[model samples]
Target chain A: MRTELTERFGIDYPIFGFTPSQEVAAAISRAGGMGVLGCVRFNEASELDEVLEWMHENTDGKPFGVDVVMPAKIPTEGSKVDLESMIPPEHRAFVERTLDDLGVPPLPDGNRVDAGVLGWLHSVARSHVDVAMAHARKYGQIKLIANALGSPPPDVIGVAHDNGVQVAALAGAKDHALHHVEARVDIVIAQGYEGGGHTGEVTSMVLWPELVDAVGDRAPVLAAGGVGSGRQMAAAIALGAQGVWMGTYWLTAAEYRLGATGDGPSTVQKALLAASSRDTVRRRIYSGKPARLLKTKWTDAWDAPGAPEPLPMPLQNLLVGEAHARISQADDAGVVAMPAGQIVGRLNSITPVAELIADLVSEYQESAARLGKTLD
Target chain B: MRTELTERFGIDYPIFGFTPSQEVAAAISRAGGMGVLGCVRFNEASELDEVLEWMHENTDGKPFGVDVVMPAKIPTEGSKVDLESMIPPEHRAFVERTLDDLGVPPLPDGNRVDAGVLGWLHSVARSHVDVAMAHARKYGQIKLIANALGSPPPDVIGVAHDNGVQVAALAGAKDHALHHVEARVDIVIAQGYEGGGHTGEVTSMVLWPELVDAVGDRAPVLAAGGVGSGRQMAAAIALGAQGVWMGTYWLTAAEYRLGATGDGPSTVQKALLAASSRDTVRRRIYSGKPARLLKTKWTDAWDAPGAPEPLPMPLQNLLVGEAHARISQADDAGVVAMPAGQIVGRLNSITPVAELIADLVSEYQESAARLGKTLD
Candidate 1:
């Protein structure tokens, strides 16, 4: 059956869908492949339990996975405090002044943004990973665990593998892949510069092959940078890859739990282009570490020239997370930006996961069929 | 102070460098630049005199150009014609006979390869451009030219342009102010993914602002491809551009004198990678398409299931094009490739001049750049 991977993962197809929404995870699993939930969104313990229970009831024992944010670098105690504490009052003053000059008027409607929004960005991130692990232990659908940023911590790895679950991590550079190997990650996702969110500066054509060369055939190599279509998936395999790991593709799926803010369609093109890597400021703005986000007014104000850099790890994310929440609820397009990949270029339209998967298989079949002629 | 290009082409920057010795034609004159001779080892034409002398003395005192073959694209074309081809027509016959036994070698190279040395690859390439143009007119340094392929087209552009000449062409990707552009081409260049001939498909990153952008109020933009580099160069100038236009970079450079001998470094890489799109291959093949190369016997053989792709452009280069003179002179690693665009990664590197220049800047820089970082 040329089923090496299917035999290993126990999925009908070798495809693996990655999404930030837990609901999307269940949907993909129900469709026959693997679906991984981005557990990073759930900030509290009880909230995670309820979500896991819901997934179990909905998916009816289908296999799925979870995603968490674990940055490569953790901030030191002195610098990892609340934004007001880590950043000098002078730095904070600069941000306010820049916004004032930009003519950013005070929020109308008695509150332009929730005052508590920017406070929980970090603790929630760390807790999300912990919570995912706990949920995996309680649920049968969780077969894998992934760290969104770098390699999962040894403890996280222990919990995953101890329970017979595979571990995967996202990486941009050759150096990062090396770290994952050291951490013994079961899969090394060599994402290219075309990938989204705080990506490394190397394009996939160059980076994927380089990683394959560097890693050899130790663990399966999943190409995950600019993949949005099946033809692209075929090209990745032709270049020597085990399978394709897709994330953004799932964002546009009908089952995606992305409740719209009423700005436009739930499509990447409409929402992503308006975003700048700056908008998705890579400050330790959210779950700590540098994360690319939509360049929101808050990110802009915080990132003005000569402004204090955001704090790191759990602390920095903790300080400003409340801001993320309130902004999402505020319906202000300027404050809410999707943490998407450069592959957003391919997210031209939205379709169901079933349709997308069928397209992948069909496109892949067509690519092979065309190449078959060259062989003849 | 000569300001090199100013004294030569009456413009700015000296970033001319490339394959196709004849590319100097429009490449030099249009930018108020110079051209050089790309004389290969076999360019023993004494008739070469009339060409250089005429150009030295004719052509509206405009800059001229020239170039030479730079080797690249390892495992070049000689393989099929080598002892491998010598495997006894009987062995080849037997292999052909047994094709039904194998499940189609799995890749293009396993299918079939064109045989024969790419006749008169470089010498004829360098000979005709500056030689023919110079022979046709007495343009002098104003008739400056470049050896689009190898080492300064044997000092012709410099010897004459020195007497008030201009020599210029295209560079691979990276740019240092005084390097080639700094050497003295009245204009500077910025080629991106949309360009042709031995390109790296880097988009405008290393192509535009890096070159056109790096100069800031300095130099002009001869943006090439998807360009013409123009929309982008126009955008580049928005980022900043001055003057812009580029042939298929190679085809446009040589001015149709290249006739179809397989040795023009301009399209070597295309002959290496077999896929017919920009994505199939991304590496430095012939003459350093560090941008992109055509798929061919040279590239395919190396990327084989168990084979190693060539080294960097410089290293792999030793095998393609002009090396065919030594096809029988040596082995399989020395011939069979050309330089073109990453688009050659899409198809052949050869193209028409109008189409080539059309993609570069054509009064489009201001709006394009404005769009890139537009405040609106």
Candidate 2:
């Protein structure tokens, strides 16, 4: 399964797994595929520094990356309070009424409503980039930085290159890939509408080839969205992608199957395992942008009639942050939401990261052999 | 690129091109790929029979197919008059106002408004099926019968199978493919959201692999949507598709570039040639269902504020049929609409069907070779 991407990232396999869990990320790296830790949940520079330090200590010198959500056009500017004020009262009232109707209880005493709203804003995301770059310079473990929303600014690309770290950006269209290439990013992850999180309407089969034909020679393109198996990995390579970027496939890894003390699967993990690909819906309830999330009462409420349109970006994230936090704290499966792709249908079991990687490699080999027979 | 599909269909390549033009369909079959003449525009059974007969005589012993749009769940069930009466007054006024605004003059001479309200209603489409089957039995030249909206009804499938004609249906989701297989479809064309005309939210890359994994062993799956290159064909095959079903690529073929007298491209063809992948929008302006079409004044008008939502299925088709005829007759580029896929970005030049098929084969070979190198 080695390709130009494996050589570029110095990994045994060219599978790039994106997740927020440090354990899952490190385990993926140890399993010979690059695990990219999402930094959007880190509120403070010190928190991100701690996560990076832990990853470095745990991965045994394997390559991993950091993902930051910095959209090219920030929805709002100035302080967090200013952005909060920009949200409409109707939207706020709808969210509150919806949460109340869902019968979600308030947090317990002494528990703060940790909405994790830090990296959603542009100013905080810039600070995240600074912290991650600084950690990369000091530890030399973070090999790549991926901007999830849009092309990284030229300065970020230049600084990452200067620090001996490569940069990647996710694009859902051919034009977006071209923009990333023009910005001089080292890699472009062509994500389709079927991908988890925020996505455009373009699907991976169409988006992958368009991105490859547009900028394959200029930069290595990593195929993302709806990719969950070895056959899909082989198909991505056949579509001219140097590698495959997977996110939803890792949510059910064994690391997430149980707590550190070995209790049982978390509420979110349980929901994912019990769900099918059709269980997810694309709505702007969690964030202002359309993101795929498990279809829960929270998402259904926002889509119902008389519900206000979601506020743009940071504002929407701000309005729903506390509701999400309360839902998570309550641990109610019917109301809890998780971002996932259409491939979630096939994610029926939890396995160790190493076993998953091995299965992927084996499946990829088998698929390639089958396709080879077609040519014969 | 000989696969089981090529052998099963007795064609030179595993490529199927769908178009409404008889000339383009015959040219595609003559060039080794199967040309499927879309029968949606033929209102009468005799008209379809005449066109099928013409295709039979001109294809030089090549195989061709007939495409019928009989949705599995018909929105309306009565006669065409009843369906026409079901259209709301506001929708009719809106269409009239939009067409008046676009400066599309009425048809010349004493030509009455031939709305051609044949394929939208269930009764008309049933008539179409009867005509196609009778023709198939008499001619023995039509090798395939494709249902665009859904799986062919059991009687249709049975009849086709009895006449030695294979039945194919288009699916945009995994469950849809399963349903088609349950209905005993011979082939499933898994189309993504990026495809032209009516499509579900699922994309081709995600949808293709899911469909293949679902029913590939039971029946052959043809990958559709955003497939305009040989590299994409190779990728689809790698994802487990037996062949590819293409539609938008044939819109700008040499057959469409010239009039019957070889004057110039039609207004619709010119619009397609000048369009980009991003220029298309999925709207219910023409049909009640959401379909991808070129973004023009007609589509944009319906998107404006206070515009009435389009009626369902046959009602919407009846309302817009005359307006479309007027716009096409006027040859106004701003108001003329045509169904297209996102791959329009790559359809910048027009070539003969033979040359296009040759290029696709060559590209498929090269892509397969490139993928083989990765496996090595």
The DockQ leader among the candidates is: 2
Residue by residue across B15-70, what tens digits does model 2's lDDT show? 99999889889999998899999888878888888888898899998889988888
Tell me how each candidate scores on DockQ against the true complex.
Answer: 0.02, 0.59
Task: Give the lDDT of residue A170 in candidate 2.
Answer: 93
Top candidate on lDDT is 2
Q: Candidate 2, chain A: TM-score?
A: 0.96
How far off is each candidate at the interface, as Cα RMSD in Å?
A: 19.4, 1.6
- For model 1, what is the C-alpha lDDT against the true structure? 0.50
For candidate 1, the chain B TM-score comes to 0.50
Query: What TM-score, over all chains together, does every model reach?
Result: 0.51, 0.95
- Superposed by TM-score, candidate 2 places the C-alpha of residue B217 at a distance from the truth, in angstroms, of 2.2
In model 1, which runs have C-alpha deviations exceeding 4 angstroms?
A: A1-4, A75-84, A94-130, A259-269, A273-323, A330-335, B1-376
- Model 2 regions lying over 4 Å from their true place: A75-77, A110-114, A257-262, B75-77, B109-112, B257-262
Whole-model lDDT, model 2: 0.83
